[model samples]
Target: MEPTPRPLSPHLGIYRWQVQMVTSILHRLTGIALVFGSLMVLAGLFALAMGETSYTAFQHFSASPLGLILLVGWTWSLVFHACNGLRHLLQAAGVGFATVVFIRNSWLVIFVSLVLTILIWAWVIFGGAL
Candidate 1:
């Protein structure tokens, strides 16, 4: 006789998107991005210590389009990770436990992170004191 099939577990395609879920996922991703960004930082510092040629190469790459894109992504990742980390700390302190508050704070984390990233880049590009 043929065996009966078992039910499949729920997956991403089965569930609706929620802010908390997104925040959690982004927190993890930003953590990974921060690691890579840190490596890039170390590489820059090493280049600076090596000599003028190495430092110039590093600077040229950093000013390139692709490098600028990665820099922006890293910046956003840093800001998002910091904001979400603070939110997590608050949750651990027994705050924002209510559903509405949790959801609202999740959105707030996203909003604040984006605003910070924009503000930082604006300062860098425009040379205005923030």
Candidate 2:
């Protein structure tokens, strides 16, 4: 008879959260969000092609307060994913993976993501883009 397999070791729930972990989790989450967001975009395009009334209705819903909040959240999610993606790309390319480099780059990703989100929204609000 074959011996029984051993149990798996501790995973995500067993450890305190860190920047690297946050980036890892959010990467997957943002990917899923992006898929749904793309579907929304396709739906809007279809609606636009249907008629002026459909397009106007889509626009009105998109301009609602809740819609605006979701837009901001999706924007930030995209920014976060993009920032961490660059970090991962650097590691994959044989750059910036030393202990100190990893630590510094992790913080850099977090900082730059925040800055990009703020700057984008600032432009939307004050630059007459919104």
Candidate 3:
């Protein structure tokens, strides 16, 4: 008898993008990004404490176009991670346990995260702290 050919498993293209899915994956990726971003923040603080030259170098690097782009990305990651973390905390507290409630809250988390990121960047661009 001939052996049967087995089918390949479904893949990324087979799956549609969903709010909950993106939020779940981004939560992890943002957590990792924040770890690295936090190091940059610490380096900036330490440089400022050291002297004017070191502080100026750090500030100059941060103000560059590439640096600004990275800063934007890292900022969004931090905001999203924070929002999703709160969602997880609420889940732990037994909020949004139902399927519909869970999905609604997942979207809510994503939307609020984006809004928070925008507000923060706006504040920074307008010369204020978030």
lDDT of each: 0.94, 0.84, 0.87
Give per-residue CA lDDT, model 3, range 38-97, as digits (tens). 999999999999999999999999999988988999989988898889888988999877
TM-score between model 1 and native = 0.86
Candidate 1 differs from the real structure by a C-alpha RMSD in angstroms, to one decimal, of 4.2
Candidate 2 Cα deviation (angstroms), residue 58: 1.7
Looking at model 3, report the run of 10 residues with the lowest lDDT sum.
121-130
| C-alpha-based local distance difference test score of model 1 | 0.94
TM-score of each: 0.86, 0.83, 0.81
For every candidate in turn, the CA RMSD to the true structure comes to 4.2, 3.0, 5.1
Best by TM-score: 1
Clashes of 3: 0
User: In model 1, which residue pairs have backbone atoms overlapping below 3 Å?
Assistant: none
Question: Can you write out model 2's per-residue Cα lDDT over 11-130, one digit (the tens) per residue?
Answer: 978988776777778788987887777877897999899999999988888789987887787888889889889889989999998878887888888898889999998988899944
Give the runs in model 1 whose Cα sits over 4 Å from its true position: 1-10, 128-130
Global lDDT of model 2: 0.84
Candidate 3 error regions (>4 Å): 1-17, 128-130
Ranking by lDDT: 1, 3, 2
